[model samples]
Target: QLEPLPALTPEFLCVLNDVCVKCYTDFAPDELEVSVREHILQDLEGFVRRQFSGARLRLFGSSKNGFGFRQSDLDICMVLDGQDTMDDIDCITIIESLARLLKKHPDLKNILPITTAKVPIVKFYHVRTGLEGDISLYNTLALHNTHLLATYGAFDNRVKILCYVMKVFAKVCDIGDASRGSLSSYAYTLMVLFFLQQRNPPVIPVLQEIYDAQKKPEVLVDGWNVYFYDDLKTLPSRWSEYGGNTESVGELWLGLLRFYTEDFDFREHVICIRQRARLTTFNKQWTSKYIVIEDPFDLNHNLGAGLSRKMTNFIMKAFINGRTVFGTPIKVLSPIYPNQVE
Candidate 1:
């Protein structure tokens, strides 16, 4: 016999329930959507099976995460079971076969765009319906750790750390406390990119070098203190550090924007608000400050929760209708950015 689940607090669960409702309502792919998705998956699997026996498929992102909405697209990764010499031509054959089958269903074909890459990646998108999916072919060695990509032949630790951190942070943001709505995963990704780009001389060049070498590259955090010594001879002790008092986290965030992006205006895009609100006994402060909002929504006035008088005043002056960023028109569905990460 099993025991019943414990009842949750009405306050927390209510917000979560609202998120679940909005999530499904906004993005849950419908029956017809599922049909199309399954069709693509089955056809690709069949094609691969015929050519390369014992291959397996794994799906990731929104489709596998259960956050998928009605119109959500598909993301699939194909793992090869054994050592098989598959050239770019072989990968194309697999994709072309599937594309031919999809051609029979005009609706699916119209919305789906299929393109293959050197690493056996077939990206499909349906422009009309916004349904998209991907087919990735990978060897067992690379498949063992999907978090870090062995792109062009190198294993990078930064990718694994960044992905892991982003995932955890995004999960924290998803709670959607009315006081803190939710930060979209896409927005969080942009923030990560911005931070990485701020690294002196840029990190992408280092990644490119590592990729060409086909080996894992060790990253050293500049301006950090050495906390631990992993080994004496091979790699130096890892260091950790932070910006001193004169510079706040807000300042660091601003530096990231100014250093990396070519055309974005940091001040025009972000608003910092410190609010005084009755804090929960469990929380950190009796009064706290959050990013609260960004881009179009003034953190102070438009937002409903934990609003301070100063925030209300600041918002009125800073925000106006019809402001745009990166060519996307601004709308305050939430505090986070709506479109692609810059």
Candidate 2:
């Protein structure tokens, strides 16, 4: 008979000591990529601080989440403290300075990184490495006067509540428990409205108008009405056309919900799910089904005139998202994976 080994006695001091060391050593790196990140963050802070004193720079995105691999680029946001107007000129200057500094670093330069932004706002990306860093000029005046602050303006009770809600919903939607996808259970819950809008007699007026126009020439359609996924159905691999879907439903839900929830909500909306009977090279030959939803309340009424698609999407998301696990969110990132805590 095999002898049984004594059970391990819990060593409270050892555990506490290990925890303290881990806390301190969390960011410490013995590898090149890690060292590079630490060096870059330190350097960027020093440079920016010298130019704009009292400015607080924060690290977020993948870097802050502790999920980034060594190759992940650093994402930084600089909030200028005190009285100062943020203008395009100021943004340009900041970008220029950082671009010049980034070029000086050998690792950065081999990548031939460049600084550029879409404008009105400034964003930077390294050309070679595809690493990106974002900067936000948080003016106290703007925070009080505009909606820019509404999205991610400052730390406030509203923001705290919004974040909490998003985190909770994201957790629930991650595993197949709610749905096998990465959209926020709440957001997916909301997106279902979009699929519903696509259904005949689009639930949303905006979608209705779009559908009507496509159905009959007399129906009115405006250019101001822009839809990101309208042409998606035409793509060879419709779902593949929108690369964002690459994220497991859980990741996509968490990221998008965190990004968009404060400004958007779908209390009353619908979605549809259907399968195309025909297939093309770009399109999947399979008569695979698609879940569709629509938002009747869409102030614009733009999805399209008809609710031609089925409502499989609504049934799945609603039924799955509604299941409560001890009042916590559930997720199934993959079809085969078990539901996990969010």
Candidate 3:
């Protein structure tokens, strides 16, 4: 189905390695940047508590998921201290009120409440930081999603590097913007994790599949099993295939493009990371879409569900081009210095 490339030279492979590493070095936020995000969360939480007492705020999405880019929006989930869940009507009302309250803040502007969204949120621009932010009520699953990504990212340095490379790749290919008829960065991250899981030596173990006892322990949030083996300290003892994969990030990055373009049958299989098995599109009854991606926690949510046929073709073609481009190596240039990555 695809053209195979000749063996790549070590020099070219090193170039690929440096390029992938550059993605992490250039884009991943520093400690102070991450701390600033937390400070903003705390400040917003305190301010929201003035009107909605017991309001607790948390930073989710890329801010907390070890994925950093200059323009990454702050996804903050807010919940009351004693409240377990929020209904639709109350969520809308609170979002509207939150927008009005945020308007009074000195350091914020362009406050907008989008109650029509699946997850009702009050959006605001933090003028001081020059960052866009959103506060959603009862967005429990997104918090769990951030935790899962963070766990995978911290488990292995290669995982983090590969994820950054994938994000950079998608951004370069212009297929990472969901609002512009393409998949989101989160969806692309899921693809990287899935590709890593499906790698021959398995770069990382499936956290949701690992268990301690006779049965997988159940931890439910929003009626979905959010259980995953997060104890990295004893992960080696628990997961049998620990420390097996030792591939360079460059190889994995190229392999990811090849996996999606040459090996994976997007029409037949779904990209699922929760388990170490082939989940078919038919099993999920999502054969309508070519690029089916299942959310780890939300069984019903297909990240690729919103993609139009034209956009799907464009995404697939980008992978095809990526496979050919990465597979056939070329002359090496001087590697980018760490200091100049910015």
lDDT of 3 by residue, 1-93 (tens): 678877988866787888889889988888888888899888888888899898889889999888767668999999999899989999999
By TM-score rank, best first, the candidates go 3, 1, 2
The candidate that wins on lDDT is 3
lDDT of 2 by residue, 254-278 (tens): 2332222222222222132222121
Query: Residue 320 of candidate 3: its Cα lDDT?
Result: 89
TM-score of 2: 0.30
Clashes of 3: 0
Tell how far residue 327 is off in model 1, in angstroms: 18
Instruction: Give a tens-digit lDDT track for model 1, residues 1-342.
Output: 112223334432333334333433444556677666666667656655665577676655445433344554466777567645455666667666645554554445442324433345555665555776666654322232122122201222342234334434334334222224444443333344434433443332212112223453333222221121122122212211111123322222323333323333332333211111212212422233333232111112212234455543333222221011111222334443233322
| Candidate 2 backbone clash number | 67
Residue ranges of candidate 3 with Cα displaced over 4 Å: 333-342
**Candidate 1, which segments miss by more than 4 Å at Cα?**
1-53, 60-73, 101-130, 139-146, 149-239, 242-253, 261-342
Q: lDDT scores for all predictions?
A: 0.38, 0.36, 0.89
Q: TM per model?
A: 0.34, 0.30, 0.96
